[model samples]
Target chain A: MASPIIITPAQVATSRDGEVVMLCLSGNWQITASPPRWEQPALDRPLRRIVLQAAAIGDWDSSLALYLSAARTWSGQQGVELVEQGVPAEVGRLAALLAPKPTPPAPQPQLADLVASVGQATHQLWQETKDLAQLLGECAYSLGRFIRGQAQFRWRDCFTEMQQCGALALPIVGLISFLVGVIMAYQAAVQLRQFGADIYVADLVGLSVVREMGPMMAAIVLAGRTGAAFAATLGNMQANEEIDALETLGVSPIDFLVMPRIMALFLMMPLLALYADFLGIMGGLVVTASILDIPSSLYWIETKSIIDLSDLSTGLIKAATFGLIIGLCACLRGLQAERSAVGAGRAATAAVVTSTLLIIVSDAVFAVIFNILGW
Target chain B: MNTASGKSKFAIEVEGVECRYGERVVLTNVSFAVKPSEIFFIIGGNGCGKSTLLRHLIGLKQPVQGQVKYFGRDFTHADRAGRQELLRTFGVLYQNGALWSSMTLAENVALPLELYTQLDRRERARIVSLKLAQVGLAGLEDYYPVELSGGMKRRAGLARALALDPAIVFFDEPSAGLDPITSLKLDELIRQIRDTLGTTIVIVSHELPSIFDIADRVVMIDSGARGVIAEGEPNQLREASPDQRVREFLNRRVAAVQQQQGILHP
Candidate 1:
């Protein structure tokens, strides 16, 4: 077996000989190592010529060609003639091959360009907002047609989506709501014990979970899970030209794809929220019974006494609104996605983020409206 | 570049190769040697595993049973570093151009140079422009792949593939979605590359014009036979081959052109 050859780092040194610059290259010029930067030799006289001597160079690759090209460029800039002496024929040929061609200069940024770009971005955002509004209006129109038995999507697909966003989501929703219940009850127990009002832990856990946490947590979970899925599915369809095929076949994607998803969330979200409320209360009962020594029957009675129909209805209404927001954001982002794999990924991320934001904002709006209504 | 044993006359050598997907065998006992600077074509009808064979040659997929040698070194059994060394000499142009959608044409072409060379930014840009110009895509460096038409995109892809001046260039269906004139121009470019630079070219295509215009030798794989059924110069094979399938595959375009001319004259 042959021993491996040791590679010396590439080096370039220069000397001034009369009006000519003597450039000597040594060592290996392989791509694995960085090449030394070329600097013009300092001379007091006007340089008439640059001579490249590469006889000492070991094994070489494209890095050598690049270095030689740099020397050629420097010679051009200094208006000096470059003469190759003993440079490998292949490297010399490569250096000549990369001879600088005239190309458009990189655009310089200016105040006008900045202002134009800003205006362009604003115009694009406005266009996007208008498109989203149009999509929502079309979705509403599709729903109306669906209710009238005239829409195009299969009932089986809608049921599948419902199962995806509803029944399939129960385990995660139950887990989150139950943890919320336990934490809320434990915190309330800490405060109420100071006032000798430990029984109120049940009221606090029940009322809060029913009115806010149950629906809000459930909606946020669905936004991350179902909304992202919807966006990814439709975005990939759009990327694959499947959506275009549907349009060509006289089927509106909004009717076939978006409406079914929206309908599934609409009917399933409130039911999920109600289920979450029960799980959360059960968690509260367990915490109170263990820590406060309250009987399960006593905790249940206190929870029933504090919670009313208006509170349950308010949570259900907010859950329904959140479902709508999630469905709209996801479908809008999917339909707006560009025809590429990266675009589909961006759509999924945007769906989760947008739907989650809208859910919180609408929940606050619901709080304000409910406060005014005194329900 | 000579191997440790000695220089191999062939640029690429495939011996006793078998290709399969799970249980389905696609090609078996496929053996061929591509000489240095030869324009080699792998031609077959639809679903004959032409691309599968190309994949094996490029090391995209390993053959179930065979040795693929590049320059006398075993490529299929080469370790990661060994394979990387062999791959550096390869330039592949996929059917759809496969230009990175996020990058401009200049960036697409410059990526290989950036990764493999220590050239400064300015020199890199110069090489990029030179390559783009070589492929007739000069001055459109700022344009994205989506902004260009099909022919321009393919040209941009060619520019990128030639970025490193690879010794071997593999093209997958170079003429697939192109108009006749554009496809012919691409064929001319392939011929020019081989004639001028002496780069070995391996192409997987069913395009008759491309095969006839540029291929120095051709290998036809048959789906039914599950291996290469014919190997020779395409024109000679069309005229003189005993295999009916090879003759039919190669002469179909000629027959069509003659029929068209006859109809016009009549």
Candidate 2:
């Protein structure tokens, strides 16, 4: 059906007349088998040129070209010239098409490079901070305008975002908070049991759940969930030029895109935090009745005595702060994302990381402020 | 306008095809056939279903009312593996290049090669370099798609599309985002690919310069009619198209060039 190809190893024979090395190739060099190893031969005399003799070669493709290129590279390294006069014209053209270009040398660094890089990073940070502050100021202004019935954002969009951030987050927040409560009660019970002070476990779990773990856990979950969603949605819109289109049509991106999401997270955070606190305290009650053999009424009385209106208010305050952090971080990262498809994924990851960091840092600050005020 | 006579010599045949996107009908009663190794162009204004037709032809979408035969084989109903075998015989370059954002240019080119061919890594890399160099993008193997310019990105996309050396290559607006000089260079590169490799080319473009320069035969789609209104060589259509709209679309470029020269000299 097809022409059969003859085979042999490549043999380089040297002639004394012109000091040329002729490589005689005979085979089916059609990329089916391994190529012949043409080792660089040691020459006593000055090598003038290396030429390929392919008169006995059969059908071929890139295999012959790769072999020729390797031979050329070897000859060039040995300071000998490779002449393509005897090879087929098609193989020559294929070899020439794939001839590798020499790469440019890398630039040398100087002392000014370090100074310029630091200066550039500092300027970028300052510019970004300024832009973020401007966005926040505009959002606040829009909020004020809305209070006076002048803002252009839709109330329906705000309600929709609120619904997503609030209702959708309940199950996850409930699961994680209940687990955290169980862990705290279990750990505290082992130590408190040695002192015959099992009732104090109720105080520990209830006070911490209401004051710290409730708000922090809810904030972190929302940071990973709603905040990331916000970044990806807005980043995709930016990449598709929809944000630009909105601006072209006399709609402010801040008013149309950012405000609704920010309002939703900001207003929904306290409610979600309160619900987490209830689930966490219930988890403590479950562990108390099952593990510590404490009466349910006694545990409830101890929890009620330990938690006051100030403790509840402190957790809500942290929840509200964490919500602002998540909302702002998501919006900032998304709006500043590169206008590309890949940038949307990066924006979502950055939003989650930054929101978690800001939430924790601000929660610590709230703890210190509330401690100093003795709340 | 159906120009093909029979299916024996045609590499691709589309007959009585109708395509819709949801409730809106985009194209209807479209029939054409491309001879083997010819550079064919599909040209139209925006929203004229040039891309929709391409999707149907490439087996990505099924037409509502007709059949697409590839080499006399029914393509509209080919199963998964059958369609994959069919796809191995052709390549497509989408709008925005659509090179994977994660991989480097070399890896992107090597993707289809790795999937379809039995070439080893060393040979695959060599072929990658050759294809990139073919598109005038030598020594840019390690660069990511995001780092490249629009023209370089398009060239990288072309390199990836040509990785498998398919019999036919489809390009969706290859010169859409390029400058005039870069667009001309792209037109020349497309011609070189067709002539050098003898690969059949089907291009969809709205740009007049590219349509006239590289197209051996052109099909004009109009959204108002929801079908192909004219088919011929671009120059033939410019001179002898019976439809006024076809003449206007082709003649507008001549008018723009003449007006530019007038503004420069007078």
Off by over 4 Å in 1: A3-17, A26-28, A44-47, A55-59, A88-93, A96-128, B1-266
For model 2, the docking class works out as incorrect
Clashes of 2: 0
Task: State the local distance difference test value for candidate 1.
Answer: 0.86
B1-266 per-residue lDDT for model 1 (tens digits): 11223279998999999998668899999999999899999999999999888878887678999999887889899885677677777778877777766469998788777656789999999999998988888899899888999899888888887887888888989999899999999999888888878888999999988898889999999999999999999999999999988998898844555554322241
Sliding window of 10 residues with minimal summed lDDT for model 1 chain A: A241-250
lDDT of candidate 1 over A1-375, digit per residue (tens):
999978899998888878988889899888888878777778578889998999999889888888889989988988889898778877877777677988999888666677888999999979977877898899888878788976676576789899999999999999999999998999999999899998899899999999999999899999999999899888877775456433422346788789889889999999999999999999899998998899999999999999999999999998998899899999999988987989889999999998898888888888899999998
Model 1 clash pairs?
Answer: none
